[model samples]
Target: MSAAVSTILPIEADQSKPAADPRDLLLHSIYEPDRDIQGLTARELEIIFQAYKKKDLANVPVRKAPSYSEAEQSALELWRQQVNHHMTMRISRYSMGCVSRQHKTSVSPAPRPINRTEHQVFQIPELLDLILSFAGPQVQIRAQQVSTNWRFSAISVISNPKNMETFRSLAPLPPVEYGQLLDDTTRSLPEPDSQQIEQFGLHVDHMVSWWRKLYRRRYVYFPAKLAQRDDLPNGIAQSLNELDVGQRHGDYHGSIHTVSRTTDLYWLDLSQFQINPYFDLLFSEKGRMLHRLGRWEIGLRSNATSETLVLDDSSSEKLLVQAVGSMHITNPPCRSLGIYCYDNCVFPMHGTHILLRRIRNSNGIRVAELLDALQSCAPQLLTKWVKCAEHLRRNVTETGHWVDSVWLIPGTPRFRIHLDNCDMSDEVSYATAVWTPEMARDAETLIGASLGYQAHITRTAYMSAEPPRATKEGEWLPEELFEPMKTECGRSNINWDA
Candidate 1:
């Protein structure tokens, strides 16, 4: 049989479902109702009915010519048209099958693969530079190790000092200065305003001069009493000896230890050393009367000068304040042998313009009382208190305990503020107040009694090339600060004749 005939053979019905009706199937598949079946007269229907009644209904041809006049011509026309359409569809399907078979049998040339010669990107020096520019320093460095050609490109880029500066500038930081600040020209500037000085509660010029003296000295003197603290470290002598090594080499130094960033504020950690008494406890007597020379940390906000203050040893009970600035403080090197801990305290400045304080339980003083005492001693810090009031009030109400303190020095607007909690307990509570001009006027309301106390303020100005992160040992000061002295000493030790 022909392929078309074989394709038209009846399909086997699914046993899972009911068998289809042969009569209905024959009517739809083989007969057109209007022309071949329904339009037929009674005699034609009888013939079709007899044909469907047969056992081999699948083989029966329902196509028939009606004898009636209404269907005689119409039936012939529809039969011819239906046969043409069926033949056309079969022919078209057969043609498509032939094409598909040919496609499967036919061989097509393998697709042209890309050739390296077609696009030599690496060969182009300009293109390679463009690509390398987008790559990071480490990536470029690694690429250099890959080939001599890559080495040339990387060296050309990195060896440029401007490129090095570009990488250094990626981090937003203040300019770093080391050594000392000796600007005789600045001393000749106009004197500070008298009214402004009174508002600051101290002569601004004297304060500035005192700070300059300390900055130039690169030394802080702690009182002999603080050296007597029971908690003082025994290895202070070793640390001082190490300092002497730098000093002997004429290496500039600062009391500043570590400088790092915490959010928008920059934290400056100062070292507390006793240049006088060999052994004095730092921050002894729970910070009551002790000169309490230890590590002092301060936070700096924007528009800040690089001036940093140091707590120097003064007379029996006093710690002298001195301002030190520039690169002298940021570059303290790693000491191979020195005192790890001195009789020192950690009074950190940890705020930008606002002061945050965390309250805990160990602090014997209540939050309110501490705030009151602070207000009495430094009424000038009223602005910080106002800014911290809401948080303080909320914490006090919630925990029924207070342990936060926010204090700011008066008149020293350039001096940064840090907020911290009293170290009485582990559970810390904190708050910040919004200080308005009105709040300054309302400071009297918050203070029960004015102690009329004044804290000597000194502002030191310095910037670091970059913010140093805390090391594994929690040391955040860059080691480069100590490198100059070591470098100079190494040069001095060289034997030219040898």
Candidate 2:
């Protein structure tokens, strides 16, 4: 090797530029086809190739070139800046990618679907609707946790106006959810019709649950039409049509007056009207508008007076008798008649007498002579009448011992007599009075025929006495009135015991 090197001549450089191979230049220039190299001219391509070749392979020099024209130079400068910016961004992204990959390999995989069955079965919109309609608020809230899609659907369905209306009408409801539905729907609808509002009044007879909720939550307010009026709210009357007035709290004393003024409801239930003062108002000229009157029940407390005296000179009993008598004389007559007196100490015989008198006194009344004849004979039956009257006066303690008797006349159901609260003294005697159905029927026929009206009398007697004797020893004796006679040593005849 040393001998060959000693004879070596000086090395000559290759002066010819390698023949310009278009393909090679193209390939070299196309380092980044995604960049601006694709549209390069021949001159630009040559410059790029030269720059690529001359520049150190390890560190390619990036230099700013001269502009071709003013516009071109500005454009080229902007392009250079953009390209530089992009290249910097790319390098950063590439480094991040490598780091991310390294980190990802060390991490565990995310969880797969846990409830495959539920995931498959629960479709977003359908599930939301079902949950809203059938499921409770608590369940709907739980469903919302599954994903954003579920939550969105749930909110949309619940908030939709049509959906809200439908939900409001549905039953087995959750009050809170139903309330929200109603509020949202009403708000979404166009302004409520003023005419309709006026005609319908303020309060609507909605579902009972809704009414209760509204009442409890203080959501009920007087309607505008009602509020503007000087009188009580019209809605009160409207609501009264559906509501059981008896079930409501308060005196119910002034209600008759309000009812008489505001409404034309024919059938008035007076079962709950306890205040005796209201009776006059009910049967008065102003109150007689009622075409169909419900049974009137009066509960007589221990302290209650024998007679409910009205402020007017005309007694309530007298007025009621007059009203009943007048009604009987009417051509068509009242379709029904019911008088319920519960736990009342006043005798029905007295009521009947007053009714007969009113009928007899009335101008063109047909029952005068019959009622007079009955009255004339009433005294002859005084013993039985007094006994019955006394029996009626007795207070019944037990509910089971109530005596009920119904008498059928020529027409209509028999009049029913319910004798409640018959005390120990009157039980046997009262039972003896109307013991048989035939007796009851006869009594009804006599009373109806006497009154000149097709009437039935039903009488029920309630007693508080101990059960009847099963054995002789258990027989209840009236110790208060009768005691075993004791022989006196000196007297020949038994002396009356005090």
Instruction: Residues 35-136, candidate 1: write the lDDT tens digits.
Output: 333234445545554554431222222233112244433443444344334333322322334445665788968956634442478767777766776674
Cα shift from native, residue 423, model 2 (Å):
38
Query: What lDDT is obtained when candidate 1 is compared to the true structure?
Result: 0.27
TM-score of each: 0.16, 0.16
> What overall lDDT goes with each candidate model?
0.27, 0.28
TM-score of 2: 0.16
Regions of model 2 farther than 4 Å from truth: 1-308, 312-444, 451-498
Candidate 2 lDDT over 353-470, as tens digits, reads 2121111211222212222333333322322323333332231111101111100010100111111111101111112333477765555444333322211111110011111122
Q: How does model 1 score by TM-score?
A: 0.16
- RMSD each, Å: 41.1, 49.7
Worst 10 residues of 1 by lDDT: 448-457
